[model samples]
Target: MPRVSGVVGHVVTFGRVLRQAGLEIGPNRIADGLSGLDQVDLTRQDDVYWTLRANFVTRREELEIFDRAFQAWFLRTPVSPFELSPPTPQSAVLRRIHAAGRPDSAAGTDESPAARGWSYEEILRTKDFGAMTSDEFDRVRALIADIAAERPRRRSRRLRRHHRGRELDLRRTIRESLGAGGDPVHRQYRLRARVPRKLVVLCDVSGSMEAYVRPLLLFVHAVRGSGKGVEAFAFGTRLTRLTRALETSDPDRALQDAARSVADWCGGTRIGASLKTYNDDWGRRALTRGAVVVIASDGWEREESGARLLEDQMARLARQAYTVVWVNPLKGHPAYEPLAAGMRAALPHVDRFLPGHNLASLERLGEVLMGIERRHAA
Candidate 1:
């Protein structure tokens, strides 16, 4: 990548590198690169940025990724005229090719396009968790893990807020940074209290939830893996503690153990009765100190019809949890409406109503969880 050769070839090489890096680039993207450089004037950085923004990026999420990749590839190269010869080595073209014969890994794992809410984000934001398979569900789990593992958006956020924007809480700032010397030479930063919160996941494993149960459990696992405690329960005719089952280090083993323990897996729904049991027994144990309680269910409510009890118990649980989110798989469908008796009853007790039918929708729970974190930290 010397700065003394063919310009077009270098741009082509960079584009190809990105394609190898996991972008869905094709002959068309390659062509766009050639024309893009001509119109944008590679001589100017902003011009080149806009050119790629228009020709290379099609989705909102890709912008962040494509930008970073562009910067790393182009800016890192010497400013002198680059050796623009075509990539000669076949091995170079083959670098980082995923099984799909294309680059699939994010350009920067840190600035993941996924975290920027890419195609998968739309899927989660738009679809249902119940309809999604275990693999798709894992992707959602990964997104949550990504967000949770990330320190903070701005470097300043990790440092003292005063540096970012907050007026120095002069007393604490000076006390923490100042030494015995008259002049302050070293400045120690205070860690800001973020929106720290806990999460509680209550999933329905009745016959009605078979399609969605595994995925939702995986979602819970992702949250828990990110160093957060999550209490999970799968209920049918009766309620069972999935907390211990999910505690195993391995996810697959945890799911299998949980499935084996829940007798009602794919059994009939006993909506009100289950909630009653939860309110009477598990709620306080799991919902301790105000956690975000997320209920994943289809809301069929076929067992003995005690909608009033369902509402009451959910209300009690809601009072203890910082926030209540009701995720209904049916909501994932395009035509789906909240017409189920159980859904209507639980709706009142919920802080947010969402679809949890597929990996796409369930991943959104991360954003919801992040919001709760912000609130708590504030």
Candidate 2:
């Protein structure tokens, strides 16, 4: 917009672009920024970066984008390059030499500079694990797996291996030892302290629930792969049994297999029908005696009949399993309530209704599982 007209036109054009990009900068802020630029000492590249950053950057992520755009658009051939360390005398020498290499009398420069390194925490903090770019999301998922791996395992009954460690069962020992000479031999008895046995996950991959899907899936995969008592499932349009899919050691292969089984990825949620299907077909089969059922959804079922159906299924599941926890993402919100039709209908039957949004929420879930495991162990 400015090239044909002149320097007078460029300032007007820049203001319009910044406003369109969600910045609150108006003619006043632009004037403030323009005036502020003159007072700010920006001899160093980073000093120029900070000068613009202080005037323009209101949010963290914007700093990175604004930095890049500012540098490329304004300071095409900056007098100095950005220094990671301080603007030292040595850096000044290098800057002067670099500047000397370029045309000393360069014109049409805005004197603005780019921001520093990419805004890792800023862009990433808002990113949902499932929707991130492959490499970026993989990093998050790997972190989730690492965190889950580091979590302390729950004390389950299967872990009680020391049968003989209690008061030595003299009566039983003598009875069994009769085959040999009555020698008080050290007979070791071990408990089945294996990983969690049954894991029934009802992930809500609906429109609203997409943000948490990545980390959530990573968490599910971590438990399922641990060779504990785990059977994973994903529910959207219907109930998907992912037990076999998760058995594969490779995360990518496991997820691919799971994706193959899940005909409905992100669609309308039918929690009631899904739970009913699980109850009718696989409930007794999967639960066996008792299993841990974690339902990861926002409790936004579109139908009350479905909610009721889910309630019935949850009731059945509650009886067959060690515990029934409803992991609702909305629960993480400050002003959240269990007022949704799905939540209202199902909350009555859930053993626990917990949040599943951030690292802290996952840690809380781990704690809850520990307590549930202890109760079942006894």
Candidate 3:
């Protein structure tokens, strides 16, 4: 009975109020609440209440807080003010550690990094993984997981109802016309639904890429966890399927399992032979077809004839893949060039060449994967 736009605005404001009341509400959850509202009778207070509660609440402890806020907002009942707890010892310790990590904290300025024209996150973003200490890498891992949640999407042939779609929904239009004196007064439209595209990540686990492999594989694991259409492989002297090993929820455990699964964990590089194996096995089975293929390697080929073979396999891969992304960590260097034989050979077939050496670079790669349009997004 209420206007759709007005209801959406009200729900969004309600989400903000819940956030102010200490609930971890985000924009995605708010949007999901709006979608849930569409399926239920908004006029029913119980339906509206349950929908909002389901979308916003993550823990049982927050139920009381949510109920109080919902009562005040929807029922217009006066409630007692909620008291805030003092910072705990753990919070104080965390604050101290955060302060210690700040570059300008030594100056005794209380201003945040934003107020000081820089941020600690920005520093971590650009810092090379090889140079980062263990604690710093731990912080970087959380950021990587967040970044990897974004998967590239492609429009599906299947259609869903949309307000502004170009295609007409003939069946819906006909059904609604029966109630409009057979005049089709309320027409409906359908649009192709977008879904995550298949992703195949080949990470180099050889000795040359030892420093960067761990973080890159962590990114791949996060991506795999985000959706169903993901495949992961690790290569040193040979190719090894890592989709099962990286399926573990814990990143450290996943990495450990991946390392154990990989026999040539710190052996010589054989980019050409490994790729040839992938093509003969996976590519032949159409695993790379219409998939966004990411190759994370340092491009150091140990075999004498590896470069020429790498070029051939890369060309074969490029033809089958919708987009080919080559991530070379060494490219992060200021004076870096594609001087390695394998890198130079594969450059011709790469759709997007990126330096995935640091967190910032991985974030950039996520963006590219999300918005890739042309076949050659160089």
Candidate 4:
């Protein structure tokens, strides 16, 4: 029967402890642990243990440290599995645990430590995705998934029952009037239905884009998981449909399956040919008719003739799609320009030219999609 605030504070304190002990714990993981706790019976030690374990433990080496930290903090008994000393002092740990459960006097003050930390996190969020190290990459993926989960929905032509709708439901009004002796007592109205817009992602997995392919696919998987109508395809020498592969709930498993399914992972680029194939085979049937198309590439095509074909395909896609967004990783560079032949060909047809080199840019893309939905709804 502990207060919810007390439990959340303890969880945050435990996260800090883990981070101090060389574990790559972040605020997102701590928040996830708190959410997991809400779903399980906290009275049961086993359930609580597993909930926190699932959220905090990612690698094998951290298990021992996490177990010791859990025992020391929750069970009120310290157990040392290794000869190495604790990273944090015992007195500091006790102070943090105790203070965390108490309300802060200057909670909303700008000079508070929490505010500073938030500012640092904001900077990290805006940093280039390609420039992030392994630890930053993992933390950013969680943020990306969260942003994608709040997917934007589009208004549909069909109407549904709504109390505040502008359109009157004449049939329902008359039917109800009959029951009320030809006098309408209750008014009925209908409003337009809403559905998620279809998002089609075409990512380049060619040799030049190998460094960015993994993160871009992860972003696609997040978009798909958000319940939006998403179709994902990776192109190198050919187009490979990855919607099914990325359907797996686990990001790692989805990436593994996607990798296994793709025949040419890091081969030469053929942007024109791939787009041509997609337009001929899938574009008209699946991609056209109000779908949002996102192409992630560096725009490096192998043959000079391919640039002409790319231009034609881009024009066709632009004509069909509601919006066509081009995400180029190199766009993060201050001196970068769309000088490549393929890029030049496709630029005119693109509706939004965005940088995809970082977590902030991806979040910005999410905002853009929401804006599109808002405009359409109006």
Best by lDDT: 3
lDDT of 3: 0.85
lDDT of all predictions? 0.64, 0.63, 0.85, 0.79
- RMSD list, candidates in order: 22.1, 26.0, 17.1, 16.8
Per-residue CA lDDT of model 1 for 12-120, tens digit only, reads 7877766655567777876786676666555788887787667777777566667667777778843333222223322211121111122333233464545666665
List model 2 lDDT by residue over 144-236, tens digit each. Answer: 665454222444554343664544555666766877787757464545454444556768766667667646766888766556666677888
Which TM-score value belongs to model 1? 0.54
The whole-model C-alpha lDDT of candidate 2 against the native structure comes to: 0.63
Q: lDDT tens digits, residues 122-184, model 4?
A: 877878765665544555566777777655567888999999988899899999999889888
Q: Which residue runs does candidate 2 get wrong by more than 4 Å? A: 1-136, 150-164, 167-197, 286-288, 374-378
Model 3 lDDT at residue 317: 98
Ranking by lDDT: 3, 4, 1, 2
* Clashes (candidate 3): 0
Clashes of 4: 2
User: Which should have the higher lDDT, number 1 or number 3?
Assistant: 3
Where is the poorest 10-residue window by lDDT in model 4? Answer: 88-97
Q: Write the candidate numbers in order of decreasing TM-score.
A: 3, 4, 2, 1
Give the Cα error of residue 32 in candidate 1, in Å: 76
